[model samples]
Target: MNALPALPDSPGAYRWFYADVTAGEYSAVFIFMVGSLFSPRYSARVKRGALPLEHCAVNFALYHRGVSRRWVLSEYPQASVLRQGRELRIGRSRLEYAPDGTVRMEVDERCAPLGKAVRARLVLEPQVPAAEELQLVPGLPHFWRALAPRAKARLDVLSEDVSVEGIGYHDGNHGAELLGARLPRWHWARVHGPEETVVDYHLPDGVAPLRVTAGVLGTKSERRPLLSEARPTSLTGWGLRVPAQLYSGNTVVGTPRLLESSPFYARVEARRDGLDVMGEVADFRRFHSPFIRWMAHFRTRVERAA
Candidate 1:
């Protein structure tokens, strides 16, 4: 029931499915973008009436102890994308929304820039499934859904010759306008506790943050007061601002570690109280800058054929 709806064929319309798994020392995240929301090309061509479906992409990243181990963001020709019901395939990677209610991901991709092969498979069985659709921004066309808040997961990295079991998560996002055109910036975090998982979305638009917790059999979602940082925010080498310290109520979330850092996006992890968190702070608007868009190309591989 959580599979994405049929995509819009409008020039700026897009949809993507995202899944992440954390197993012991290994954590992996992947995104299948039908309209390529993060694509600089998409940002550039939208005004020219470029079809979002014509710029499909797949992004995969592996992390170990808060450091990037492998990364791939490949853009392929529209002809390379295949969709059969709730199942989708772009290039060599595939995602299946099965009739049995399990989600499966199979990836065979080359790490960006380096071109080293990274292959993996992940099966996620949802223990807590989120059913409602949400507005990513107030009165915006962007929609967000958490398909699985907590799942029993198994991840196998075939090329790396590794396998492990851990907790996993899945979500879907889609919108009618270019991402940068709809929202300026945002911070999102997912923290997993022994008995619960909480995902928070912080958008500084004079609105309370959206906080969702999956603890028992289902989930509790509400508007939460913004978190206060203990210390002043710090700037990254690329000039992005991030919290120096974070607190969940009276308790600190722990020291944050950088997993991936770039000019417009960052992924970090923090641990304490047996809680594991993965957070992302992004500036979609900055991606529209000519310089930033130019820098984005080196990290993305263009696959012209299936």
Candidate 2:
């Protein structure tokens, strides 16, 4: 009968570093993540005189060409680590940072599903200073989130024989618990404008007492919080609901266009306040157990504006 720690102290605690790059009409997202989870049958196994243990994994996802092609790689128990605040490597692919504040990412992955190799080399230079870390949940389980809203990127993708040079964004999150554990439902979006960037995060029922409705808007040199809102409009061909409008206070600033949709998530690009908004909204309940999904179905309703 002891109290569990608010955040896990083990090295195997859940955490992830993510970066996203977009240029013209092409985009790519990268994730270097690790997590530890207890088996759902732990109680049953313990009752049968078996020790309850934890499972850990290192996973990464690369969404190429606006989510048209996605490559996922995972290693159990994690085989990679961040070194010197500069390099992150898993297997052979790695993302590194230079002393001059430039980032380089080299990818050479053989994807079995595509029956081919996906290769790319990308360089990103910050066009603005890093933004202050945004705390999703204030205390105890405070998951730290940070953003670099704008950067100039030069990319050469060997797989598609495509080359792109333009602006990009980078964000990171580190926490002791999985995101699903912290926030059951939320909508996260990022807008890359001609001169500035905007990030809107909404958590309806996850953050407790006060609904989590916050936004950051600014250029690289400056940023300010804004009053914002998000609403899903209609279901697209991919079966994911599209946002009708993104509001900054009482004015509609963006209109969403679906870019990709899967069983539980949707990626969209919107024209917002004369800028371009691109990001995803996901429903984690579908990925959970059937009981959890059923409970979610009863407790949540997908709303659409008429």
Candidate 3:
């Protein structure tokens, strides 16, 4: 058989944040995805183009602390297109709405088709309130920075140089789900700037040890660690913590099964002083784009080094 056209295969993760600004407080969520169906033989890839609807599930729950009458503003779809003097440069994406009222985003790097690299951008509407100030960490890396109104956030991981700028949102009016969890076609995300750190978690049932991945990218520096033997058991207000549980996955172990998943809320402790940091985790809405999956058929690489 004639060799098929080359398809790009790359692994990366996505981070998402949700918050309620009208209520004076908010929550954050991060998701890390590795491997793809195009190549590298990803088990998570849906068979016969079947969408792994379960894996695509994105749900967040927020607890009100200081404010009451908390509610979500609007769930819309946004697209970030780069242009230079009326000419499209690169970068594009579509957000989706899941049945659980959670949001999912399918990002596409269009520059690949034109033989260029694309940087993904997250666009928030002006109607959405933004933090008024920045919170500077004392001892962490110089790049770490924090901002107020921590409602929604997302992370775009790229192996090559990419730019994230000039992002804007569009209306996501996709129909609702009747039952179970359906993939999101569009979404709305809150904005919290500077950046903190990247985190990694490994479920005992993970396919590979080093394959466990998670992280936070600040405006300055990025933190990423391989989760050796860890998994996020449960999540509560202010933080998502890892709990002790039974992890089942082995060559002789047959298929991995959850004997018991420990329950624990999210809590941020001072890595140095062992102090609990104040925070919250809440549910917001977003959408996924069919365009993202279409663009994934191709891959883009950075300009070669000198």
Best by lDDT: 1
Which portions of model 1 miss their true places by more than 4 Å? 79-84, 226-232, 246-250
The candidate 3 region of ten consecutive residues with least summed lDDT is: 171-180
RMSD of each: 2.0, 9.6, 18.8
lDDT of 2 by residue, 1-306 (tens): 011112233432454555666776667665544342212221122234322112222222344443556453333322333554467555556767677777776766554223356677777787666666555655635353434467788877787787888776666555544445445555667666566655666654544221122223433222233334324567666465556775543456666655555555666665444565666676654435454444323322121111
Error of 2 at 295 (Å): 19
Candidate 3 contains a number of clashing pairs equal to 43
Worst 10 residues of 2 by lDDT: 297-306
List residue ranges in candidate 2 displaced over 4 A.
1-12, 36-67, 73-76, 82-85, 112-114, 140-142, 206-232, 235-242, 246-255, 271-274, 290-306
Per-model lDDT: 0.80, 0.51, 0.22
> Candidate 1's error at 80, in angstroms?
7.3
| Residue pairs in candidate 1 whose N, alpha carbon or C atoms collide under 3 angstroms | none
Q: TM-score of model 2 relative to the true fold?
A: 0.68
lDDT of 1 by residue, 77-142 (tens): 672323447677788888888777899888888887568998989899998867477787778888
Question: Among these predicted structures, which one has the highest TM-score?
Answer: 1
